[model samples]
Target: MDNTKLNDSDPYSIRGSHPILRGQWITLEFSIIIKTYYTDSTKVEYRDLENQRIQNIQGLEDILNSEEIQDSEKINVFTNRLATLKNRLDVLEDLLKTFYLDTSFLDHVKKVRKEIVNEKG
Candidate 1:
């Protein structure tokens, strides 16, 4: 579907003494498609944050489960870190519902990812 067509309001707009059947058809079709993948922009950000937290927890868990680690205190530390990360993820998920979807936020994320890749090179 064309982005322009998705963004058009004329076909979806209701303004006439007699209802436009074509316009209603267009609007109904558009609404169905839009609703299927329509996550609030804030939810997307929250998802990213959640994924990051899960990655961190997995890393910590791997370290804790390693046979090379003989120190019980060190394992405890890793467990604590994972718990803290889970808490942070919960907070982000809660805030996701309140976030506005903005292009700039996504651009910033992309730039940060690029920087990380560059630094690793």
Candidate 2:
């Protein structure tokens, strides 16, 4: 929320999604905790232009939702602009759903949502 803007040039990725498996020594059952973020470098290629745009829109949404930005003098202006961007991204996502087949893209979107909600930027 300072004068610095969020980094958008390089891909943003979640870095904590490795699964942890837990099992009772006496039992044959195990539970796996799947973290929301993924650290794999190979997955970056799966984010197409639409997916990148959605991630950017979500970043704006994150900025607007931040407590630090709440008292800025230009709050209303930013809120409106970010809201418009969110709506457009939502519509575009709806249209692109059928066209997005690879699971990696979906994973990328989910990671973005989680990171934005957690205020990573």
Candidate 3:
């Protein structure tokens, strides 16, 4: 009576049936998960972008303070670029809300998994 949990090394593990219906459901759920994952990942990327933008603005301020490169034109250009980056950061903040909404997408995943399990049994 060998009672061992399923392991990767086991060749005869019951990985379950490959029914088309089940496969399709699983695929759909997996796709949703991936989409949600990507959305969440993008939020992190946006945060990093925001941090980089702040750093850039700080550096520009430092440069403006120094007597070197005291050209008004160059300072104006940097200010305009900083404004653009700030606008982009605002857009990314909105996208973060959308990414949070994506979390509700998991309800469908749970429902699908339940249906598959019930049908298989």
Candidate 4:
């Protein structure tokens, strides 16, 4: 894959999921994501996001523990920024989930869905 961001317009767009396929890629017309793991670049991006998320969480924890910030304004600033960082962390989580939608990630979800439907049936 090209050394670029994995956006909608990335190599996957042009390859049409070629790089994401499993087994004999050339022989298969289509492949499910459950049959594959995260690509090299995708894994790299995931790690980067994870690292950022950890750092942000640690910073927020530090701010909460700090005794000097008893004022509301500074507390509000930290809290607000913490909320934004939490949002970003959530997005990163969902991005990883998106990447693993076809793998065991969705399998467990599908199993639960099936159980729910069966109960209704």
Candidate 5:
């Protein structure tokens, strides 16, 4: 998606003409993938990923709030951040695919579950 063509006035500019279902589906998939990192060891990695996402969001906010940068420059920065986010999302999708393809992922899940049960018992 070319952010240059985005209409700043249009509320749907970010997702373009895509339906609400597209956003919802992304959210659902992201949520499911995040849940896979529930184990204590993986939680740190998840937090790091999450922090990077938040930093990108903050970068957008900073760009928006800056008075010195021209609107055109802001749009360019926004476009870069958007691309970064999209790339990260693609990475998550790839991870999800790997999770499904490799049975070893189940072993990690089982180990986490055993740890939880041990703590509870």
Candidate 6:
């Protein structure tokens, strides 16, 4: 018998599972797109809102702690602005979670998902 092996050059033999690999790539691309959208400075307004909230919080703290009597109107305005900022940030967070559903960022979650699904089930 000849020593040559059959199907050595087959793409399927070399590539393992093509469909599974393709699915992984598509998921990765989608995850990257969502992460880009979440972090994009120009499109997302969370950065500014967060900064404004921090400044307002600090200013409010200072005003409240001062020896002089603080203006009630200013306190009310600051409280209202803080509440609005928090609501906006919460909404942005929920949107981000809905879009970026990949768990690869957390190694433990990735491991658990892979193990649970891949094992004897």
The estimated TM-scores of all candidates read: 0.37, 0.37, 0.35, 0.40, 0.32, 0.36
- Across 6-118, the per-residue lDDT of candidate 4 in tens digits comes to 44355435444446642234222112221221121122222235553223444565777789799999899888886775575345445545554356645654564456347
C-alpha RMSD in Å of predicted model 1 compared with the true structure = 15.0
Clashing pairs in 6: none
Among all candidates shown, the one with the greatest TM-score: 4
Ranking of candidates on lDDT, top first: 5, 1, 3, 4, 6, 2
Off by over 4 Å in 6: 1-69, 104-121
Sort the candidates on TM-score, descending order.
4, 2, 1, 6, 3, 5
Preferred candidate (TM-score higher): 3 or 4: 4
- Higher-lDDT candidate of 1 and 5: 5
Q: Pairs clashing in candidate 4?
A: 34-102, 34-103
Candidate 5 lDDT, 1-118, residue by residue in tens? 7564574335554454555544654544554554544422233233336654323333454565577667786678786875675466457755555535445764665576467557
Instruction: Report clashes for each candidate as comma-separated counts.
Output: 0, 0, 0, 2, 0, 0
lDDT over C-alpha atoms for residue 83 of model 4: 74
Candidate 1 regions with alpha-carbon error over 4 angstroms? 1-55, 100-121
Worst 10 residues of 4 by lDDT: 34-43
In model 2, the clashing pairs are none
lDDT of each: 0.48, 0.42, 0.47, 0.47, 0.52, 0.45
Q: What is the lDDT of residue 89 in candidate 3?
A: 42
Candidate 6 achieves a global lDDT of 0.45
User: C-alpha displacement of 108 in model 6, angstroms?
Assistant: 12
RMSD (CA, Å), each prediction: 15.0, 18.1, 17.1, 11.6, 16.4, 16.9
Cα lDDT over the full model 5: 0.52
- Candidate 2's C-alpha runs over 4 A off are 1-74
